[model samples]
Target: MLKRRLANTDLEISPLGLGTVKLGRNKGIKYPTHFELPSDKEAAQLIGLAKELGINLIDTAPAYGDSETRLGTLLTGQRQDWVICSKVGEEFDNQTGQSSYKFTPEHIQFSVERSLKRLNTDYIDMLLVHSDGNDVEIIKRFGLLQVLNDLKAQGKIRATGMSTKTIEGGLLALQQSDCAMVTYNLTHADEEPVLDFAAQHNKGILLKKALASGHICTHAGEDPVQASFNYIFAHPGVTSAIIGTINPEHLRSNVAAAEKAILQQ
Candidate 1:
């Protein structure tokens, strides 16, 4: 697990990041299987294991039911050893099991402040706009990127970007911010243009759904996981591929696959 400098930022992160949605939320998820939330001890163990496996990037969001809170508790003393990447714009409600988005300057500011409190950190390493499928509209209409930029200046966050859904929005995000998180996997290469642009411009690119949310891992293939990692790490634009796997064995396997993939590259 080699670390790559996140373009336009001083932060250096591993090629594979751990997505923490499953650590806090279980409802309204699209995983192939259902499971209960792990206890604090179990979650702490997972975090420790990730660190042992050379994963420095941890992606979490306020929408991920208490993920920030748990990480705050779990990552008590070793916060500096990890690069915390969190998001704003999306909020989840446990009662309805639904997520809502707000991209106003006021909401964005409030969300980042709250995330800082919840994650028990003074400043977040990376803060991305959690787009609600209205990627272009949200970035254009809300002026949220400016707000995020302000936060960066204020030292609340180090870098800013969007988890974009469309190529148009992805390109726009990279133009305006430090990076863009796009969906780039074996099944979905719709965002390749975005990756190409990042490569050309030297802007950061963090890939979400790198394994198609675990669906591709189950597909019939010789080694879909390895194949996915090879495809992802092979791309020069990728800063890191965020994989949400709670199982320790799965995480280790993924790291192994990602390491091999990077070596092949």
Candidate 2:
């Protein structure tokens, strides 16, 4: 497996990362029904598998119901071996069964503290601000950039970034915040400019929805998982892509694709 250096950070992560969105709730655009909410035992197995397969990064968020908890349960004793990236500014309401977005500084702090508890780690490797398309207000109202920097100084988080849905949002975030940024590849090819900017600025770029919610490989005749992995690896600016798979076979195949892609590179 190939390791890429995160911009402005000491972290070096594998190109393919494990995403835990599906492990929590299934409200996204193209939710997979192949797996149920993973138990702590299952999450431990998956984390161990990911480590053996050379995957270094795991992405989860507070909005992902029980995902942080499960990750915490699996990774409690092995904190130094993996790069765990989680998000703030969004909370999952079990009663409503929906995600509620809030970006106030207090909320950000509260979310981080809660995430720390759930992940069972003292410090998060990377912390991203969950976005809802309104970048300016989100930044101003939350004072997120400053708060994240403060947390970094306090050693609660190593790095900070935003998880945005639009290229415009990404670009704006890059200009305003010194932290890294994440975006989905499927709906926002318009993000090429932002990606170029990040590369030039030496900022970390994490990719989500690289599989287009499994639509890309599903549309192609090739194995959807392999195709999705290969497509993201073909991009130069992508530092890492998050993939969620519960089936051991599928996970192994995805890892194979990642290994082959690295060999080809």
Candidate 3:
């Protein structure tokens, strides 16, 4: 559970971050199986266990149903103990089970303000632009990165980045911001160049869909979880991999596997 400095930022994060999507939303997700949202007590227990296991990074978003609110309640009075990474540009509707994206400066301002209110926090450690697949256009056309940097300058956010979808966009994001969240599992190494750039430039890179949303973990009869972690941590630029497991056993097992992977490095 050793921590790494998220490059260009003061925040130090664990190798494996706990993604909180499962704590709030259950509809229209890509997980292999169906699941009920965890109760408040259950969510609190999971968060506590994660903190005890040396996990200080928690990834959430307005698009993740009520995750921000739940974490806000669960982590009250202990906000300083963790580095919270939340996102803007995407919002989820539970009743319709739909998602919407808006990256206008006004919407970005509104989203960050609402997230601050929902999380019951004064500032976010990292604020990422939750892209809607039009990564290049979002950066070039909308100018949301500038808005994020403005927020950073205002002390509302410590760092700014984008959860990018394309190689060009990932590179561009790194050039303009503090970090980039890119996909880089064993099956998805197309984003490896993004990691290389981050490593070369001393920027941060957080991995998303590192296990292919739990669909492609196993490979050639190997221990799927171990193999996945091994591939993820073998790279030099990955600041952390966001794992969204709600099961306590799965969390523990993932941490163990990640630790082993890091030790091998």
Candidate 4:
């Protein structure tokens, strides 16, 4: 349960954040297995369990179906108790299982406004551009980062960032924003520069796909989740890793593993 300030922001996120992808979207995901959506009661219980287990950061996005709405209802009165990290730019359509991206300033503004209403919050703790792999083009051409910063100045968002795909994009995001989300785990270390730069420049860093979207394999008698936590938390640059799951046992286990992993730092 190690909490650290997310770069220059006031949000103190835990090393392990609860990802709400499964809480909202059950289709068009990259997980190894398919599953039914959890009941509202179950979803609320899982989120409460995450908070009880000392998770302070909760990652959600508009693309995550109704995650923001569920979280808003669940965390209603206890808003100040947790840090909510939501995204913009990319949206998902559950009916057709199709996702669309728009990085224009107008879309960015609209997305933030909609997310604020959906989450029932006046201000977002963290906001990231849900990239579509065209990271360079988005940053260079769209000027969405400026819009996020403007929102930050307007007090609608506390921090700004991008969920980048390429290392170059990751580095550039660090230079321009308060944080950047990158893929880093036992399987994928190609984005280390992003982590390294974040560490050096005092920028926030969040790890995505740390468990390889639940596809990581382990050796006999070894724990895959614990191994992933150890690998991710050992890095000082990592602010948090977004792990999406709806199981209470899995959340407890991951939190325990993360607590142990962070102690090593």
Models 1 onward score TM values of: 0.99, 0.91, 0.98, 0.97
Name the weakest run of 10 consecutive residues (lDDT summed) in model 2.
Answer: 178-187
Stretches of candidate 1 exceeding 4 Å from the true structure: none
Pairs of residues clashing in candidate 1: none
Q: CA RMSD for every model?
A: 0.7, 2.1, 1.0, 1.1
Candidate 3 at 101: error in angstroms?
0.8
User: For residues 8-125, could you state the per-residue lDDT of candidate 1 as single tens digits?
Assistant: 7899999999999998999999988898999998898999999999999999999999899999989999999999999999999988889999888999989999999999999999
Q: What CA RMSD would candidate 1 show? A: 0.7
Prediction 1 TM-score vs. true: 0.99
Candidate 4: regions farther than 4 A off:
217-221
Query: Which parts of model 3 have CA positions greater than 4 angstroms off?
Result: 218-220
Error of 3 at 108 (Å): 0.3
lDDT of 3 by residue, 1-265 (tens): 9999988688899999999999989998999889999999999899999999999999999999999999889999999999999999998999999999988999999999999999999999999999999999999999999999999999999999999999999999999999999999878899899999999999999999988898875455888889988998888999999999889998999999999999999
Please list the C-alpha lDDT of all candidates, in the order they appear: 0.93, 0.77, 0.93, 0.90
Which wins on TM-score, candidate 3 or candidate 4?
Answer: 3
Clashing residue pairs in candidate 4 are none
Model 4, position 153, has a per-residue lDDT of 98
TM-score of 4: 0.97
Task: Point out the higher-scoring one by lDDT: 2 or 4.
Answer: 4
Question: 1-265 in candidate 4: lDDT tens per residue?
Answer: 7688989887888888889989889889998889888888998898888888888899999999988988889888989988999999998998998899988899999999999999999999999999999898899999888899999999999999999999999999999999999999888999998999999999999999988998884434679888888998888788889988888888888888888887776
* RMSD in Å for model 2: 2.1
* Candidate 2 local lDDT, 1-265, one digit each (tens): 6788888788899888898876777654265444467676787788889889889899899888878887787776789999999988777886677777888888889999999999898999999898877766787766787788899889999887888766677877776554445555544476677788887887778887777756565564666666556656666667888877766677787789777765665
Error of 4 at 238 (Å): 0.7
